[model samples]
Target chain A: MTQNAAPPPKLILRFTIIGLVIAILATAFAYVGGWLDPGRLTPDRMINTLEDNAGVHEGYRRNHAKGYCVVGSFESNGNVDSLSRATVFETGRVSPLIGRLAIPGGDPHANDGMPPIRSFALQFQLPNDEQWRTAMNAMPVFPVSTPQAFWELLKASQPDSQSGKPDPAKMAAFFAGHPETKPFLAWAKTAQRSSSFVNVEYNSLDAFRFIDAGGTTHFVRWGLVPEAPFTPMTEAQKQDPDFLSRDLRERLDKGPQRWHLIVTVANPGDPTDDATLAWPADRRQIDAGIVTIDRAQDQADGPCRDINYDPLVLPDGIAGSDDPLLSARSAAYSESYNRRTREEAESATSSTQEPRS
Target chain B: MNPRTAGTFSLPARLLHWLMAIMILTMLFVGVGMVATVSERHVWLVQLHKPLGIAILALVIVRLLVRWRYGTPALPADLPPWQRAAAHLSHWALYALMLAMPLIGWTMLSAGGYPVTLFAGVTLPDLVSPSPTLYSALRFAHTWLALSLFALILLHLAAALYHALIRRDGVLASMTRSRKQP
Candidate 1:
């Protein structure tokens, strides 16, 4: 038995060597077949290539048609400096843009007027020579920092653990997990109590790089100051919840509702990397430009509602800061986009097939 | 000849299995790490993340071809039918995910209108339209799938360990070491 086992061990050894060689050969073949190209996997390069190809295919035309394209149109006005000064670089590009407006609840039709913080993600196309840019959520800070924190928050904020209704205790647990959100929590809590008059100021919570004409760089935060004065909503106003939307609609109907898009430059000497801290209002307020909203068009009926807003889309001059959140966002956004599109394509194909009699 | 012991896996099968195992595991680890450490300062990780993903993508294709040409080894006769089915299903899912994740990532990057560079400045062609909404949904799916894949792998490992140590079956040894009997 020992003699027989020894011969088997040698055979096994020979087989292992051959297996290793085969694997090496297989990997080599794959590498040469364009399957191993790293460029295809890297976020930045992948985005750039996608954008360039989209440009050729005119795929972004619908995105541009959305209101965000107005940023690029401003360039034709020869007011690039004024535009640069007043706006966050993310809001300045004219690339096709995508925005998602959600009710912040599991239900699609959850009360729209519940003082939910409306998220606005703008993907602006940079000029031919510029990098891409994306601006998001009105707050300069997010509720959570890490993915685990985000998960915790989601778990807490999710409707009743069993019933699927908003669970206050869970929400509290989420808040407790991250003490840093005290300021944001305070703001959200207060805002939720207010009526139609609630003053919602969007913060560009992430820091971004702004390259000036002289090639000097400044890290900046963008703040949106509605031209209209602040009005706090009453309890009655919350009952009618669509009041904010109606207000926006009424203002747009009366005339283009405008907001002063202000850029607060980071003090070069101070160099604060975290966006949670607000730049003191005393910081020089550069007039980037007026963001004029031509009466709230029926976005429900428009192409704007259908597009995605990815932060990685930067025009040439405006570049993303080395924010890990930005990279994660970019990667996550890319993955989401692919899956959705594939599903859409699949559904479309299925729909087009002839039905069984 | 040792009649009591079972025959081992062929050379090509064992090599493909381990090579793919290392690459897949590395890719999963890198992916989780990348998502977890998202800060502007971690540009180096981002750089490493993309290339590693591409490497996994490349290796998966080769693994698939080899798998196709030479099928997996048959299970031990003592192995239960359900366990065998579970093993096959899990392997197929892993293969599918290995292929799908990179392809989706590549297309998503393309749609965002960015260049896909590997390492020392090489770039790949675009694969889709630059749609932000599309990018977001795909990104979400990618993360979710990755999480699922991680869970599946854990289960796979648990099962293998159970068979190897508890059952004292030769299942794990088939892949870990050569199975050629004299």
Candidate 2:
């Protein structure tokens, strides 16, 4: 009979109220700390800041200034019905896909064989004015999660004026503070550079969601895996300035160069918000379709030259993930598109005026 | 000899209770590590965290099923109504959170387009579509649930201590000590 009994109802009610109050307060704190509101940071301002700090090259893109355009057809096997509801995924739908493959750098004249990350961007125009655009990179993961952090990374990595070399102290400090960049750096230092763009597997670092007609939804990230085996360049091959683009052109002349589009689906408890984090390889993957490049074109006069490959241009059944970098890229690409297009327009008028004068 | 079964939890219930305790504590620490560390190990820790969460979810399911099948021992007659209600509420809350946190985590990852890799290279199917909006909501919910679970655990621990040390009651022994019923 000395055992303790349950407390009265009033006391229980009081405890419950106290617990709820604490929960609400904690939620408020998280919101104030910027965990709940991911959109509080703007991509436009970050892009402009990068341009100002990095010194914008007048007619060139803020990044990936060097590229070669190509024309291709993305034919669907119509077997994607179970995975996607978009018409582009339907069988026998042969839509024109314009693409650009480039070595990573701000200078358009950067040597082709110089070791650098490669990029592959594509624009798929479907039947109903729906466009699916994506830009892929050789790097599996990005360096940072947010635009603000990306700006900081750029600032930190900037070479000192007097030395014309990046300050090791600044880089060390940056790396020490930002451990998320470690995996990428480790891979970059160890990975051998591919001799040709076609030999590289290009990844769309951001994740996207696809909804099927049955109201089923899947979170997916895609990559264009090259059929060409990877071959590192020799010293002789490194001497060629346009080796990648030139090799691609020659191969297209012989026959269509192809790549497989593979989409990986996410499981429970996976990290989806950070592009810097990679998903484990054993995850479920679906081979959606094949992308065939039947022709090559020069960037100066190519259809893809002026086209902005905003990754957010998704068709029905496809949508953007919560990765902050995805939206940031979309904004930055549009900004670059507007600025470059404006500069081209002005240059056109100026050349006409100069000839008249 | 029958002290455990007469007024204490059965052997299976006691084992599951301790197992869950260790797992929940480990989960709290791992959750903190996942956020606090930025090293290469952070990625490894995240990989570990996913499987651990799924394990907790699975264990909690079994624990609940066992509890439902085999009724718990009665509380002491002297225990106040408020205290009894509090104990019942807290226990159920812990169970709810254990089930929810992992499921929410899975849904969040699915929405964000990341794969949840369990131990032994197994991956579960996505339960929802990838939408930035939905992903954000799930992420927020997961964090909150973790925090709530943390708070509830602390309260539970404090109550357990009060029972064991201050009351000198057999309540704590019910789950801790296992012996055949008289």
lDDT of 2 by residue, B20-99 (tens): 88887777666654443222333455557888898898988888888889879887666679998999999888988999
**CAPRI quality level assigned to candidate 1 from its DockQ score:** incorrect
Off by over 4 Å in 2: A1-45, A49-54, A352-357, B1-182
Candidate 1 residues B1-182, lDDT tens each?
Answer: 22222655667777767777776766666565444333342345556767878887887787777778866666665556898799889988988988888888787667655655554224566787665546556767777887677667667776765555445557777777765444
Model 1 over residues A230-327: C-alpha lDDT tens digits? 66666676677466556555554676544555667777654344444556667776766555545333443343433445565544345567545666
Best by DockQ: 1
Q: Interface Cα RMSD for all candidates?
A: 12.0, 13.8
lDDT of 2 by residue, A124-236 (tens): 87654466888999988987887667767767767677885568898889878889998788888888878777888899888888889886888888898888898887677
Q: How close to the true structure is residue A87 of candidate 2, measured as C-alpha lDDT?
A: 77
- Cα deviation of A99 in candidate 2 (Å)? 0.6
Model 1: lDDT to the true structure: 0.53
What's the residue-level lDDT of A54 in candidate 2?
48
